[model samples]
Target: MGISPLNCGWGICVFLSLCLISFTPPCDGGNILVYPVDGSHWINMKVLIEELHARGHNITVIRASTSLYIKEKSPLYKSITIELDKKVEPFFIQYLQKHIKAQVEGASAFTFFKITLGFVSAFSQLHLLMCDYLAQTLDDPTMVKSLRDSQFDLVLTDPAIAPGVILAKYLELPLVFNVRWITGGEGHFAIAPSPLSYIPVPRSGLTDKMNFIERVRNVFFYSIALLQQRLIGPHYDAICEKYIEGGCDIISLLQEADIWLFRSDFVFDFPRPTMPNIVYIGGFQCKPAQPLPVELEDFVQGAGEHGVIIMTLGTLVYDLPKEVSDAIASVFAKMPQKVIWRYKGKRPSTLGNNTLLVDWMPQKDLLGHPLTKVFVAHGGTNGVQEAIYYGVPVLGIPLFFDQYDNLLRLQQRGAGKILHLSEISQCFEQSLMEVLHQDSYRQNMQRLSDLHRDQPVAPMDQAVFWVEYVMRHKGAAHLRTEAYKMPWYSYYCLDVVLLLLAAVTLLLLSTVTMFRFLCYRCLRKPKAKQH
Candidate 1:
């Protein structure tokens, strides 16, 4: 029998609908407002921004007028510029150079104090400057009204500074963090339970396994971190009080973030307690190596069986002290491996024929090259992570900040060696040789690489998924804990402990009193009968 016309039309409609639904994505474009820290931090943030752009999210970046790495114009995102007095990054870079020089000279008590004081003062001022910028931005009705009217779906930021956190709260937007450091300390401490017994503090230069002495040292390191929180947080507190609805501390604001795309994984980071909301996106910036430029590829090919070694101190450090540079050059001279050193300083007199000095090189490409043997580095997170991604053993010359601590983790894992600045001249060549010849170094690193790559989803894809999840759900409040809202005593269960202790004490005292009364009654009756 022939099908009815009405039934055939209904069947066609159903088929087309299913096809459309199958083709559509689960999540669509979202309007994202990003507040990012400049310089090296921007490098990582830009990668995420680009990925989001490709995924069809509309991104608006709020940047300072004097921002270093963040340009006013970008194809990836629109810019909401905030005015500032002077450039902060250059000042920070200058301070780091001075600090590196101080470190290389020696670690006397006076030098330590001077360096610490200088660094703390610089960072404190930077935070205060951001607070001022935030104030200026909020105080302007035009800016505030524009922000509110934009109707951004979410606020993405690096919580290393507080303006972004406060702004996100003010706008009543779901917040997400691309974070490693918050002003108070490492991002993990800002939310997670970090027991100093096993979780070593960042820049602490200590390992996860600690002896009694090391535990004491960890406590001392934690004290410094607390001191930093105390020193740096007040400027932000005032801003929060003025702007946020009920007022909040910097840590509280950080904790409210719906998602944290953390930069380090177990490969580079020690295993520690982590929160459900924080997703590890370690090596998200890493990918298969691209083709090297003709010159670099030729140099690598020339190395033959001897292989190549590449060194870069990241963007922050360019010029080492003359003597230190000379010492490094002398050490590289005797090595059979070809060296590609990214040095912006004047040529060292002891420079070797095998070493190729350039203003910059494709670090990822070189590290991924089959001929590259060892990475000589200053232990920056970016380089360290890339080293893990490529399974290259590192011979580190740690200069400042978290450099030594980063290299120290690799040392503990048997993947790298740290040659301190003081010991560099005497031991640099030998350390390089050890890492070059040691099969164990490469093996351990390759093992880490395998584990890091064994994830069910790539780190970048995971990061994108969570970001889209936040956008799709409005916010992941179900996943977020109420612990941040509780007082310290309540959060730690100290109050409950105290209450239990008091109840137990009361019960014990009552029992003792009752026993005494019964004894007294028995003894009194016996005495009366005897009389």
Candidate 2:
């Protein structure tokens, strides 16, 4: 059945025409641009992008750093990495401006030195780096103009990175934010627990009073949050030489967003508020199981005899203390179950043969294994999600920040046990035994896993829908609200009521003091006259 040259040419033309018809333009793919907070943050996002691509959608990624995408080994290597002048450079210029302004004859060296040096020390802190970088990025004119020219219909960002919110507004686009961590406010999502529950809210079931030390630490944390909003944000604007842009305010942006997809589960027990836009797609980032590596196959296969416990503290918090590692080793020494700890950093000498210590392991794959019974991990959102997806019980040893929150949520759900950092030294063996032996934890995990698996639509499908929906609706502006634009005083009711109460209380105190003073004077005069 040899075809003529003319027939072959016609067949080629037909194939080309079909592909063109099926291919959607980049702009028509609902032109969704996703700007994750960091490269690592994109792991969950990749699952959603794959789903969207399957649906014949086009996506563009704008990354904060190249390192994030490089590590993922994604096929989509054609990504745009955003570069900015060093974050510290702006602070340097601002300090110079202040130093120059204060260089007058009246300006004392003490004042100048104190002001300049104080900021220098503060700037040295590593926590300020991301915020500073975001502030500077917003200040660039060409970058801002480029975003405007792109005309992306929807902007997906993590709230941790403020620039995404600002850029969304600059382009007059609707936003969909992945609330990766908890912050205060309605419809806020956290892979971790909310600090608000620690406050005395009735029925919250948290009754323990904070110690002086705990209170001080909390105060410091809150102060940093305030400083970011008040100082760093405006400082960013000053450096950018532009007023803040985006959907007007945080509330407005949130309201205007087509969807607010949280990477949380119903079992995690996040504070649920009644909002149309808010959707619980927590385990959406997790997809169906993939196969494990060939080298690890034997260990996983041998798991059913005594069962298996997978221990991993997640990638972000590696290099645990020597004491903690020793405690873990002690537990592994006793356990009959084949323990596979994803031990990062140099392996300590105390490790046992029953344990498999590897630099990294396919976490989701391990959880999915039928022989796997429990997960021993540092409570992270990613870890929690994986555990839920596979119905694996957990022993969560939270180190700091949202790890505490994430661990607490698992505890409340009865899906896991919360091991204090201190317990890692003394009670490590006992805690591991309890976690492994407990039937309730395992059952709870299975229950949650079922709920997560039974969602009406997969997280990827939901994310893809909202993304394209924004483009279809030309930026879901109808969903936006006026609450974000209200003045702070109005929002908190601090302006009028608090001021009136203060004024009235001071006036009454003054009157009482004056009356007492007059009475005392009269009594003294009478006593003196009699004498």
Candidate 3:
């Protein structure tokens, strides 16, 4: 009589339930599809992908054959490479090379537009080629069937490229954007509120706090960007229609994105309005510096108390003009500090005894080294972020794109100085001396570094958490604002303005008619009496 059959059955049921709960694995992270704009973007996103993989998410990367530099051989992730038209790759490279040369030579204002239009034309050609290839792939019954079978959870892509949005629409998956630059263009503003009065346009070379003239200039730049977007946007829409069942606009798709992971932090960027869906995960790709190669380590150590200076112009800028190279070498020759320059071009005839020129260098590692004194760079966003991360002062020689704006921000922070290529021959030594001899530059950079590092969770961890959050919640719809769904006129309240103006006009017209009738009545009585 110790236990009845019913009691035993109840106990057995409870035991089995507890066992089931205990053995059940944590929610498996969802399948993620990553489509980066280029090799550089892939490099920036590599850390985030690896973190997601570690968390048990299935990751698939779709890259163009021309951009397969980061070969993912990991068992955790898979990669699919698509080939572009034969002519596209070579033509793109040639166009970029020509533009870089013109930029370095300080192309005239008229030539600048000519160069810009040429680049845009080349980009459009390549874009059309990619679109055609994608259309062909998606049109194939087998390929479409295979993709539908995969049942992807979400698409993480660079929205800077229009094709990414098209791919997302074709797959019928939630989209999450990964923007490598701080200033996302007009499409970003449409999704999030960025007041033009305060927030400077990207590449405008203006700061957050602006004068009247600066504000006007910002608006002008924004208007130009809008015009350009309008002109080129229709082509993208047409291309997207060919692949996806229901044609979608790139901007509309972007507005519906689950979240935006921006490669920027407030510590380095000016404070601006942001929507709930925008997440700043800057410096997630950065890691503690690895040990340098023995030869490089020896050279760095050999400088002794004099220290070393690191110089690089980023991956795209392979070389400098001979005269520019000569001028830079001449300045380095007089310095006591050792210089390690990354140069892929011809050896400078005036190469200094204290300078060691190499075709490639581990830039982040060099910046993190204790012996490194200052960074002389092209002011690319990645390089500037690395410099700030390591608390190294910069002497930036920005050429084009957002480089000028990046340097401008750095200079504003008192952590760096801008050295324009046009004035480099004359100001190279002076700017170099200022960054090296001035204590303020180093001190300011160190403070920013501290702020950047003093977070509850690491940037990489934060990024991984948010990415998984969106997946678990299925697009994070709660984070999206109603602004995305609103039309331009409605958001700006143009209709309200029109209503108020109409009311005022009607009132004024009625009062004027009444005044005229009173005047005629009074004057007509006097005229009748005289007659």
Candidate 4:
């Protein structure tokens, strides 16, 4: 009676509970700072941020006012907006508008140097604004104090913004890159093994499969891109020095990054050698198809059998030349399926009864809908990824930047067809019809979608896991490749090649000398016998 059965059971339960609690891992909540380059980059970071915050990480985003639009406000994160010079935003926008118009007219017509220089000029101007912002942030005592107090564990940055790289160096934090494009320019290639023979230069419009001449052209374009980066380097260096104490260069900062999350997947991209630190978190931004707004739901549902076609040029391309719009409308009018076109500019007068124009549309939701037959897009990376995610075949009218390369990959995958802006008026109808009617395009798209979803963990979860893993381990130095530290000649084993060449030459010369000596000895012995 001294020890009761009930007391013994309670004691056993308490012991088990204590043991479980002792074995459980502690939550490693970290302060993460995100430095996004532009609105597109911010959009791409949304899902990753959401997941990290959900897992109890504190996120702080530093963005320009012009580019700071967070659709979902969360208590788990804070946003710091920096106001730029009034003239800066307008100039950047105007320059981009002009460039887009020129591209629409004919990007292929422009010389390679001209295009490369144009991009350099645009990036340089943008970087100058970023530098000004960084200088202001550093000069402001309150801002500097706050950043220091936060004590961020890691910095997530976009390499496109040189100042962001400088800021990471200033904070002395481990850097992790979030590249929104297929390739992250020279900074990415510096860390990863990017063979020019296979990996096409960004914006070069060359595919991975290149012939001898194409390979030479690819190399030439890549050289120009590298030259463009070098030309812009000194300016970036100057900006860094003006802002931070003992400022470091962009290349050095990038090379020191712990990890790089590329928004490109091998399913959509060609196979290439990647280091352990180079993580492919493509489609991480894509969420499940949410319910469309009532009106959109009704419209898509109304297209019962024929289905609907969604056309969007993404957020940047707000203004399309009248001719291009008219040609698109004309093609949509001819098609039997209903069309929903997202046009921010003037409503096209040629819009038919079967078409509806809106200033914005839920592109991902629309693409995921079963009744959506085909997507006519500008081949932006996000749009391509969405189309691939939803298994929607695309008819890409690539205009500029990485659009051409994205479309080229789509075409190679047989999930899409490409129509140049110049050819849109003539080929748009046929391309649209082919993508809609052809069974192969849909089949291939479905296969791609399957491959994209075939991973063990969801893309967003994988991203969050790796991020927390970095924080847990302090830094992922083991994952980083030694290639980044090696010189070009050393990385490629050129020294070994030279040594082999020297050995072969010495052997050849020794053999020739020995043969001549043998001949002379034989002749001299015959002369001696005659004497």
**What clash pairs does model 4 have?**
none
The C-alpha local distance difference test score for the whole of candidate 3 amounts to 0.79
Angstrom error of the Cα, residue 260, model 1: value is 0.5
Question: What CA RMSD would you report for each candidate?
Answer: 4.2, 13.4, 6.4, 4.8
Alpha-carbon local distance difference test for all models: 0.89, 0.64, 0.79, 0.79
- The residue-level lDDT of candidate 2 at 445 comes to 87
Candidate 3, residues 379-399, lDDT tens digits: the string is 887888888889999999887
What count of clashes does model 2 give?
7
List TM-score per model, in order: 0.93, 0.71, 0.88, 0.87
lDDT tens readout by residue for model 2, 411-437: 878888887665666777777777788
What tens digits encode model 1's per-residue C-alpha lDDT throughout 325-383? 99999988988888999999889989999999998888998899999999999898888
Model 3: colliding residue pairs:
none
Residue 44 C-alpha lDDT in model 1: 94
Candidate 4, residue 180: the lDDT equals 45
What is the Cα root-mean-square deviation between model 2 and the actual structure?
Answer: 13.4
Off by over 4 Å in 2: 1-28, 64-74, 84-149, 182-228, 236-256, 488-531
lDDT for model 4, please: 0.79
Give per-residue lDDT, candidate 2, residue 251: 35
Alpha-carbon error at 466 in model 1, in Å? 0.5
